[model samples]
Target chain A: AQSVTQPDARVTVSEGASLQLRCKYSYSATPYLFWYVQYPRQGLQLLLKYYSGDPVVQGVNSFEAEFSKSNSSFHLQKASVHWSDSAVYFCALSMTNSAGNKLTFGIGTRVLVRP
Target chain B: AQTIHQWPVAEIKAVGSPLSLGCTIKGKSSPNLYWYWQATGGTLQQLFYSITVGQVESVVQLNLSASRPKDDQFILSTEKLLLSHSGFYLCAWAGDSGNTLYFGEGSRLIVV
Candidate 1:
């Protein structure tokens, strides 16, 4: 079966500091990868996605994710953090096969930015 | 642009009561619809998906059911609610040939 893993349950970062959220996935074949962000009381919003080509993809809010087939990882990164950037982040994976397409999400990582 | 809407932004009901939630999509036709549930601190779990009207597929068994009576509408309901059903319910739709899902505002359900 396929699954997503977000090792860090919670991360605390200072404002204006660089941010990185780690993600690992388990799948037999190349998988469709994605990064989503959820604000309090709000539904998730897509940050970036990787289907094929381009190891790095840029997304909204100055967020970017790098897809590493070798490491089986798709980590989200940002040059500088902002107060409003504090939220829950999720990593997802999908493989389009005979069963159609559906997403399997990771446990998610909550990031808190102080000052 | 495409938009998804979920009704009854929030609901509070007894454990054994009945429940119904609705979702509608606009600016897209024949889109793939899906129902996702999130526990208070858990990740998103797919409950059901519908590729076309009157055809719904279950992805998880949580004592809940979903239906797609119209191309743009999807409904999630349960004859008897359980306390474990309390959480956030999100509705999403994907474009044709693309697996990228767009989520709605979401509905918060509290079953006491």
Candidate 2:
């Protein structure tokens, strides 16, 4: 079974600071990885996804993620974060061979940006 | 231009009462629909999925049943509601098998 692990439960940073949320996956095959963000009382929105190709993929709102096959990691990074960027982030993985395409998600990391 | 809609943004129900929730997908054909549950400020747990009309797969089976009557409509029903069933329910769909999913706004249920 494919699984995702997000190590940080909560992260706080000042505005204009760079941000990185760690994510690790356990899967034998090359998995489809994704980053999603959810605001308070709102549905989750996709930030980006990585299937295969270049390790780094850009997403909406100036977010990017790098997929490291060797370490089985897909970490989300942003060069600069704003106060509006504060939200819960989730890393998810799905096996390519799995027909259902069910996504296994991490526990999530809550980000708070101080002004 | 795919979009998913879930009705009744929030619902409050009593234990033992019957319940029904509806979801509809737009701008897609024969999409793979899914139902998920999430606790307050928690992770999403897959409850059910439907690959096509009239077929539904139960993943959690938390005293609930799902049906897909049309190509774009998925409905979740329960004979009797439980206090434990109170949570946020989300509807999602993928353009095809093993494709990326899009989520709905979600329906918040509070069972008392």
Candidate 3:
């Protein structure tokens, strides 16, 4: 069984400030990691994903994440956050042979961006 | 382009009443479908999943069931609604080993 852990429950940043949300996973095989964001009254949207190759992956809204196998971490980062970036972010892990392609997700980090 | 659709954006049901939620996937064949529940101010929970037609797998059985009657349609149902069942229900579909899942608008259920 695989699981994900998000160390931070809430992360606050001021406008134009850099931000990073930490995520760690526990899986036997090479895990597929993803970051998703959810705004108020909206569904979860894909932020970025890391399968293999490059340790760092870029996503929309100037968001990026770096995967470290040694540390088993995939942390989402942004150079500068805006007030509109306030939302809940989730870290998920998926495996190829898993039944039904079920994904294990972290509890999520609620981000608050102040202007 | 692939998309998933879930009906009844918001529904209110009484305790002990029957409940049903529908989901449909487009632009893909034999895709993997999933039903997820999110409690108020809580994390997401996997409820059910369907890989192929008529093959449904239960993840968290909370007095609820899921069925895939057709290739593009999936249904979530329960015999009786409970206050605990009141939450946000999301429908998602994935292909190619669930690399990325596409989500629907989500259905909000309020058990009164």
Chain B: TM-scores of all predictions: 0.97, 0.95, 0.96
Residue B102's lDDT in candidate 2: 79
User: Which ten-residue region of model 1 chain A has the weakest summed lDDT?
Assistant: A94-103
Question: What is candidate 2's lDDT per residue for B1-112, written digit by digit as tens?
Answer: 8889998899999999999999999999899999989888788888999888999988887999999999999999898999999999999887544468778989999999
lDDT of 1 by residue, A28-93 (tens): 998889999999999999999998899999999999999999999999999999999999999999
Which candidate has the top score in TM-score? 1
Deviation in angstroms for B83 in model 3? 0.9
Candidate 1 regions exceeding 4 Å error are A98-100
Q: Predictions ranked by DockQ, top down?
A: 1, 3, 2
Tens digit of per-residue lDDT, candidate 1, span B29-65: 8988999999998899999999899999998999999
List model 3 lDDT by residue over A10-91, tens digit each: 9999999999999999998888899999998778898999899999999999999999999999999999999999999999
Ranking 1 against 2 by TM-score, winner: 1
- RMSD (Å) per prediction: 1.0, 1.1, 1.2
- The superposed Cα distance between candidate 1 and the true structure at residue A45, in angstroms, equals 0.2
TM-scores of the candidates are 0.98, 0.97, 0.96
What's the true lDDT of residue B105 in model 2?
89
Off by over 4 Å in 2: none
| Rank list by lDDT | 1, 3, 2
Highest-scoring model, DockQ: 1
In terms of lDDT, which candidate is stronger, 1 or 3? Answer: 1
